[model samples]
Target chain A: MIPLIQAAIVAVFLGTWQMLSPALGLQFFFATPLAVFQSLWALMKSGLLFYHAGITSLEAVAGFLLGGTLGMGIGILLGRHQLLAKVLAPFLTAIYSLPKAALAPLFILWFGIGIDMKIFLAGSIVFFLVFLNTFHGVREVSHEQIAILRLMKANERHLLTKVIIPSAIVWVFAGLRLSVPYALIGAILGEIIAANRGLGFLISSAAGRFDTAGTFAALIAIMFLALVLNRAITFAEGRLMPWRAAEEGREVPI
Target chain B: MPGPTAPPSRKSSEALPLIEFRNVGKTFARGALEAVRDVNLSVAPGEFLTLVGPSGCGKSTLLNMTAGLFLPTTGEVRYAGAVVADINVRVGYMTQVDHLLPWRTLAGNIAVPLEIAGRPKREIAAEVERLMTLVGLTGFGASYPSQLSGGMRKRAALARLFAYDPETLLMDEPFAALDAQMRLVLQVELKRLCRLLGKTVLFVTHDVDEAVALGDRCIVFTSRPGRVRQAITVDLPGDRDLRVLRYDPAYLAQCGALWRLLTPPVEPAVAPQGRRE
Candidate 1:
C-alpha cells in the first residue's frame, strides 16, 4: 500500500513536470519525464550510465566504510574516556557545525582531482555523523547495564566487547544510515567540483552543455542508488540486532 | 510471635558478618542531600536480609555501597573483612529494571557473566541452558528481552545474575515493576534459588509484604537519611510456600509490624514535608 502511494506520488510529479514543460518553455531548465527517460535509456545503451554510476557508488561505499570505521573507533574512545571527550568536545562541535560541502574545494586542492579527493570528501562528511552518533550511543548506554557487567568481574575488555560495543552498534547503524546520503553527496559534490568520472561529473557536464534531460537522468540514478543503500543498511541493522527488530514488530499493533 | 521480634543477630550468630557497614553514611550532590546516615548494619553468610523503606530513603544507596558502585561518603562498607573500595565483583547487583542487553538473546544474556569469566564454550552453553530451565525459561532461550513478557525478562535477568554465581546478591526492588501475581511468583522463585544455592542476599524493596515473604531478617529504614528503625527476624520456615504463607496469620502480623515501622508517624516528623515522596 505504501509502495502504491509512492508510485502514485512519483507519477503525479512526472505528470506535472511533463505537462508544465512545453507550456512554460521550461524544457531547457527542467526537462520533461519523457525526455529524461529517453536520455537515461540512451546513456544505458551507450554504457556511460554504468561507468559514471559505478564510480559514484564506489566512492560512496569506500567513503562510508573508511569514515564509518574511523568514526566508530574514535567515538568509542572518546565515549569511554571522560577527560579526552571533554577536551575534544568543543573542537568537534566547531568542526561539525561547519557546512561539510564547503570542504570539497579544500579536499580537491589537498588530494588532487582524482577519486582520492572524492573519497576523502565523502569520508570526512560521513565521519562526523557516525562519530557523533556512536559517541552518544556508547555514552548513553545505561550505567545499570554496565554495572551489571562490572559486577560479573568483567574487565575493561570484557565490558567493551560484551556490553559497550554491542549497545553502541545500534547507534552506529543509525549514524551509518543517516550518513549514506551525505556520503553520496560528498562524493558527488567533489566530482562536480573537479572530476572526470562519477554521476556528479555527468550531472555537472550535462548541465554545462544545457542537456537538462541528461542531468535529470543522472539525478534519478543517484536517487535510486541512495534508496538501495539505505535499504541495505536497514537490512543489516535487522540482521545484527534481532532484539530491535522484535521491538519494532511488537509496536505494529499500535 | 505476632509482634516485631527483635533478634540481636539471627542467622549465623557464631560467624562474623559476611557484610558489615561500620557507621556508614552517604551524602549526595555535594552534601546537599543526606541519603543515608550513620548506618551500622551487618549480614551473616547465606543470610537473606531484606531492607525496606520509603522512596529516597537510601535503601538502594546501601546496596550500591556493598556492590562498590560507589563508597559511603563517610565510614566504610566491609565485605568479607575488607573495606569495599572498588567494584565489588563477589556480589551480583540487580536493579528494578531488567538490565538484560536488548541486543542479546535470552541464552546470550544469561551467558554473559560466564563468558566474561572466560568459562569454556561448552560450559557456558550448559550453564545457560541450566539457568533457563531453572527460571522456567527453557523454551524461550532464543527469545530477546523485547520478545519476552515482563515476568520472563525478570527471570532472564535473574538467570544472568546467577550465571557467575556471585557470593552475595544485592537486589534493589528487582521485582517491583511486575504485576502483583508475577512479583509474588518471582519472590518465591528468588527465595527458592537463594536457598538452594546458599547465596547471601541483600534485597531492598519498599514492600513490607515482600520483606516478610523473602527475608530471614527484615530491616525497616526511616525515611530520607535512612537509618535502620527496626530489625525483625522473620521465623518462617525456609521451604514454606509463599502462596500459603501469605494467608498465614503470622505472616500478616509480620507484614503489619514492618508496615508500621516503614510508615512515618502521623503527627510529628518535621510537619510532614510535601508528602512521603
Candidate 2:
C-alpha cells in the first residue's frame, strides 16, 4: 500500500516535469523523462550501461568489504583494551571527521585515474563509519556479562570470540547499513573527479557533451543499483537478526 | 512412641569449605568517604549462604572482592585457604542483571564459558544441550535472549554459569529484577540445583524472606560502610520444599527474626528552630 502511494507520487513528479519542459522554452540541455528513458534504452542496447555499472559495482563492493573488515578488527581491539582505545581514539576521530572528498585530488595524484583510486576513496569513507559503530558496540557490552564469563574460567581467546565478537555483531551490521549509501557516493565522487569508466564517468561525459538525456539515464541507473544494494542489506539483516526485528516491532507501534 | 531425629553428620573432609574471606576489608576512595569497612565470612562447601542488607550497604562490593573482580584495600579473600592472586576461575559470579548477549541464541550464550575455555566442539555441544535441559530450556536453544522473558533470561544466565561447574557460585541479586512469582520459582530451583551439585553458594540479596527461603545460613550486614551484623543458621530440614516450608511455624519464626534484623531503627526528628518576628 505504501509502495503504491510512493509510486503514484513519483509518477506525478515525472508527469509534471514532462509537461513543463516544453512550455518553459528550455534548451536541449534539459531533457524530458521520456527522452531520459529513451537514452537509457539506447545505452542498454549498446551494453555500455551494464559495463559502466559493473565497474562501479566492483569498486563499491571491494571498498565495502575491505573497509568493513578492517574497521571491525581495529574497533574490537580498541574497544577491548581501554589503554589502546584511549591512545588511538583522538587520532581516529580526527581522521574520521575530516572532509574525505577534499582528499580526492591527493588520492588521484597518488593512485592515478584508475579503479584503485575510487576503491581507496570509497573504502576510507566506509571504514570510519564501521569503525566507530563497532567500537561503540564492543564498549556497550555489559560488565556483568564479562564478569560472569571470567568466573567460568574462560580464557582471553574465549572471551574475545564468544563474548566480544558476538556482542559487536549488531553494531557492525548497523555501521554497514549506514555506510552502504556512503560506499556508492564515495565511488561516484571519486569517478567524477577523474575516471575513464563507471556510471559517474558516463554522467560527467554526457553533461560535458550537453547530452541531458544521457546524463539523466546514468542517474537513473545509479539509483536502481543503490536500491538493489539497500534491499540486499535489509535481507541480510533480517536473516542474521530475526530477534532484533521482533524486539523492535514489540517496542514501537511500527 | 515416635521415631528419633537423625543425628547431624560432621563436615566431610572432601566436602570442606571451598571459599572463605577472613577479615576482608574494601574501601573505595570516593574523594574522601570509606565505602566498606572490616568484614569476614566463610562459604562452606555444598551450603547456600546469603548476604542480606539494604541498598548502598557494600554487599555487591563484598561479592566483587570474593569474585576477584576487585581487590580488597586492607585484608585478604582466600579461595580454598590460598590468597586469591587474580580473578578466581573456581567461582562463578552472576550479577543482578541477566547480562545475556543479545546477539547470541540460548545455546550460544550457554556455550560461551565453554567456548572461552577452549573445549572441543563435541564437548561444547554436549554441554550446551545438558545445560539447556538443566535450565528447562530444551526447545528454546535457538531462541535469542531478546526473545526470552525476564525469568528465562535469568535462567539462561544460570545455564551459562553452570556450564563450567565452578565450585563456588557468587550471585549478586540475580533474580532481583524478576517479578515476585518468577523470583520465587527460580529461587526454589536454584536451591534444589545447589544441593544436587554440592556447590558452595554465596548469594547476595536485599530481601529478608529470600534470604531465609534459600540460605542454609543468612549473613546480615549493616548499611553504608557495611559490616557483618549477624549470621543466622536456619534449622529447617535440608530436603524440605520451599513452598511447604513457608507454612511451617519454625520457618515463619526464622523469617520474622531475619526481617526484624533487616529493618532499620526509628529515630525522632529534631524540631525546627524559629526566628523572632
Which number leads on lDDT? Answer: 1
Q: What DockQ results do all the predictions give, each relative to the true complex?
A: 0.69, 0.50
For model 2, the superposed segments whose C-alpha errors exceed 4 Å read: A89-98, A249-254, B1-18, B22-35, B175-197, B206-210, B237-244, B247-249, B264-277
Q: How well does candidate 1 score on lDDT at residue A31?
A: 89
On DockQ, the candidate that comes out on top is: 1
lDDT (tens digit, per residue) of candidate 2 on A34-145: 9999999999999999999999999998889889999999999889899988998789878988988988999999999999888989999999999999999999987777
Q: Which digits, one per residue and each the tens of the lDDT, describe model 1 over residues A68-132?
A: 99999999999999999999999999999999888877887788899988888889999999999
- In model 1, residue pairs whose N, Cα or C atoms come closer than 3 Å (at least 3 residues apart or on different chains), thus clashing, are none
CA shift at A84, candidate 2, in angstroms? 3.6
Give per-residue CA lDDT, model 2, range B167-205, as digits (tens).
778898887767776667777777766777666788898
Q: Of the true interface contacts, what fraction does each candidate have? A: 0.96, 0.74
